[model samples]
Target: MNHWNSGTAAALLSAILMGGSAAVFTTMPAYAQETVKLELWSRQDPSGPLRAGNVVKAAERLNKELEAEGSPKRVEVAVRESPAKGFDDDALQLLKVFGIDQGPDMFIAAHEWVCAFQEDGFLLKLDDYIAKYPQHFGTIFPSLWSSAKCPDGTYAIPQDAEARMFFYNKKLLREAGYDDAFVDALPERALSGDLTMDELIDIAKQVVDKTKAKYGILHRPNKGPDYIMAFNAYGNDFVDPASGNLLLERDKLAAAFGWFERAVKEGVIPANNTAMEFDALRKEFYTGNAAFWMYGIWDLGSVAFPTYGLPKDEKGFFADWGWIAGPAAAKGGSPVSLTHPIVYAISASTKEPELAVRLLGHASAADLNTDHAVTTTHIGIKPEQLEDPRYAEAWPLAKATELLKITKFLPNNAQFGELNGIIYAAIQGIESGRLSADDAAEFVIDEASASLEDVVVK
Candidate 1:
């Protein structure tokens, strides 16, 4: 069952903010006397439990700290929940409609949307804030800050960054005759790219033949930035940023898609994968119906402790689950992964821009943010935060961190969403046998290149 339904971003926002106004006012009887109350907007994975409550708590904490410091006016945070679907486009449209005068005070968004937000003048330039508040700003990962900066200047501050990898069910592997020795050695082999893709396929085949597991892997079919890691591992990219042209690297892209298609054809992956939503695929993996799943670090928390309606505790079910870098496509190639940070931006229309910036800064602090990561099982962007004991207890986070060194950012372009749509259509076409791999590649490139022509590069 796909837990994630197609919901409009605006509708989700309304749902999250339901009774939020009353809650905010209840928390702050003197809120009107406060310098400013900022309305922060963000979309969370509906299936994930952490986002909404955490943001509220963070705001409460920030307000208390300010009050303790004898500041007469505390910044009150009003959060609006946004749904994950078409969220980036919705945020862009909101920025355009509201401009700087009456939009949100702050927003949580993906890194890929940074360029679009900056180009549209929907975000506040954060260079001044960062400079004045160097102590608070210095805790973030340098790479994360760089990723959030536009060519013209800095705009957003990164909130969370993620790494994607392959996770396997160790019990399933062992039950199929692969033991600890084999499992422990998988990571190094996978990283070296010497782990031939064929070997993986063979193992999946073996598992199905020996065990009762329905499928060996559960990968989703949606085309978006998420698929870039697999494509990049094979030394292929969808678009060329420098020339704003679609890359015509047919052989590599075809090899990647061909491998995926072959997995489905071989009964290693479900034939109905194209119709599966991410949440359903995850549930299948968590319930032991599947042996492997490809997903971001966000999956770590729930998978490590299987809580959704499972009769067994997560540890009991996931005790044998292990993580490895995604398999390399060739010998001597570094294992490739995609790195994208979830960034926070101030709305151009915010009534409390300064307060919103302060709240964002406080939340991104190394210690405080590390706590959030530990609780949510997210990877930390700050180097110092990784050393914290809280992060140390999160095993999945530590494993994900190991994969970060080899990660690459997704294609950052104004036309990224449209490009992803083209890529997804082509992938579906090839997988379903509606088009040849070569034809699909050509179609993706032609459509993407045309779309890129209008993308503002700055």
Candidate 2:
């Protein structure tokens, strides 16, 4: 937080070389402390409540640092919570606020939407600040910073990341006559691409046929990142590397949609999946009425362990429950694990950009970020967090970290949020029996081409 410029050094040298009197020190005027209030915008999400709270805690930490540095400025963080149900909605609502010049000093947002904000001139580029504060950001995992970057520079600071996978009930698999070893090897099979997407459905079909479970496979009943992992596994990245434009390949799109089509046709995934309540889906999977629940890692701390009374310790948890990355589309193909990172960004219109940056730096401290990680079952941002005993105790985090080897991120395109909406709608269409896999692919193309700009179809 302290910067030593040339002027300070010049005054110090003059005082020392000229044998200046003590009056040089005594004549300096007192600093009346100035309180800088920084407002932060965040959604009212229960899963990662500390996303906003940590910034508040950072304000207190920054005040102490200011006191120690004998500086005249102290920071106060005021939180503005939005009532959006998900990050996509929150980002849209925030854009409207920014358009009106009412955006806060800083905001917590989904990483994929950071570029969208940057395009609108709503962000403060952070490359210089990140370079200035090595004590804070130097230890952050080098890979995670990519999520916060735009073409020009980094625009946000990654807060936390979690792995997405299909969580399965081992008890249900065993009830379907699979032995312990077969169930335990699922994660490894997924990573090695020995398991194919169709094979996962076949296993789920067995659970539905031989067991009393009503659902074989279940996913989030809304538009979100979990389902996108399936699309990614089927070789649809939805963006072009060469042109930096939205990319849509017809065959890949159908192949991904085909997986869902097969699931619904086989009665593995319910036809009304998109219509089901969120908590009901969790109850079905956690209470052993479903075989697989496609979701993220944080569900353990937020819902699975706490609400459903699942085993908390590693061995106990694995004894009845397990997870696997989205399996390959074909043998020898790569599996997929999608990581949706939440980030903290400062507004371009903020009055105190430097103080805001330093405050977020303290918020990203190893201990504070670990507090959020361990409490929510999220992976830590900094490498030093691996040594934290409390973090090591969070067994789910350590286990999920293995998936980072093949983890992928949603593209950081400005139009991706809107394009994701179209993709989700096509999913709903397929699950509800209104569209075949091929039809869903057409629907996505027509929607994206009509609405989004600069789309590249292959």
Candidate 3:
């Protein structure tokens, strides 16, 4: 794979510029002279293309460019898939792999894990490389840089961003007697605070009561990131960004848990909500049986349209579904969107760190990233990609990106996961009718306090 032919530019340049024959280049040793295979680990994403897939594609491009430029080093990217059971599970597998010195040459991970991985010596510092290869990463969006940062150093390059929002079935809403104008104004009303969470639940209940849809509103079937938006909307500051300490108020936690508890009691959400699997929950909305679904933009391609086989430029999807940011819990309060980004990191154990970083930059370039964004339902991480014609074709990308203003991201902190799990358990208990909201809140605080000691304040 590393053999450069006589037809390469090196032969031409040697003949023209150096006044030598093609034989003059035969003795120049090729870059590491064998096909450099790099292992890349990606958490499986059935909803869309794994962000690591983008880097693999880019590495393929880099290989061709290298061969064209008469460089003997050809990159071969080997993908290692870890079960996408959950972020904690996937992160655990990665951490364990690194412990055994069997980690990949590169990896795609959530930015929230940045702090923990750096502290454990599992991540490579990229500041030096970023300075050495400015051209590859120079054009990255400044805002995305936050996803790659940690106190230790910048650990990775931003690969893709996903916005979690409220999705309603337009067809069901129409069947429930909403007019076309009303359907169009629903999301705007949500943004203006006219459509609060109470009203959202009421609307869903009405849809289910009046229409054939079996369900009304659906949230993540399992404990995942969607509920954090609800917590934030109810005025819970889960992290103290200044010191990266996990923090939450008992009153706010109770209010948020109570809202969801009411949702199940009102029959908009099922009591068995926590028992359903990811695929079944997604189908509840995509199959149009439920009035609303709270999920991320990543589903726009991998699951939503592909499951239905809808064509691009068709009005069916737009006519049948409308998306809104998560509604506020009360009147006069604003809705919130949650942004989670996947990042590409080179392994400290990699045989060739420079190649991995270069491949990441190639994958994040405007042309390559635009394709991934349009097809995978991810927002463009580069400024130039928004103007690309291919990216413009995916209508949701524009609207989703516009809604980035109200986004709340989980901070990069080690304790954030423990706090998140504590809250999710409370949600499950309260929503399942196993515990009252007050009891659930107490449980959350007690558990969180125990996990972090005095650091769990306010």
Q: Whole-model Cα lDDT per candidate?
A: 0.67, 0.87, 0.75
Per-residue lDDT of candidate 2, residues 27-89 (tens digit): 112333687878888787787888888887887778778878888987777776766777877
By lDDT: ranked, best first? 2, 3, 1
TM-score of every model versus the real structure: 0.75, 0.83, 0.75
- Mind sharing the TM-score for model 1? 0.75
Q: Against the true structure, candidate 2 has what lDDT?
A: 0.87
In terms of TM-score, how similar is model 3 to the real structure?
A: 0.75
Q: For residues 311-413, could you state the per-residue lDDT of candidate 3 as single tens digits?
A: 4453666777779988888988988888888788877778888777777778778887777777767887766777888777777786687666677778777
Query: Which pairs clash in model 2?
Result: none
**Clashing residue pair totals per candidate (backbone < 3 A):** 6, 0, 0
Error of 3 at 411 (Å): 3.9
Model 3: residue 33 alpha-carbon error in angstroms? 9.4
After the best TM-score superposition of candidate 2, give how far the Cα of residue 402 lies from its true spot, in angstroms.
Answer: 3.0
Candidate 2 wrongly placed segments (more than 4 Å):
1-37, 44-49, 63-86, 100-102, 242-244, 349-352
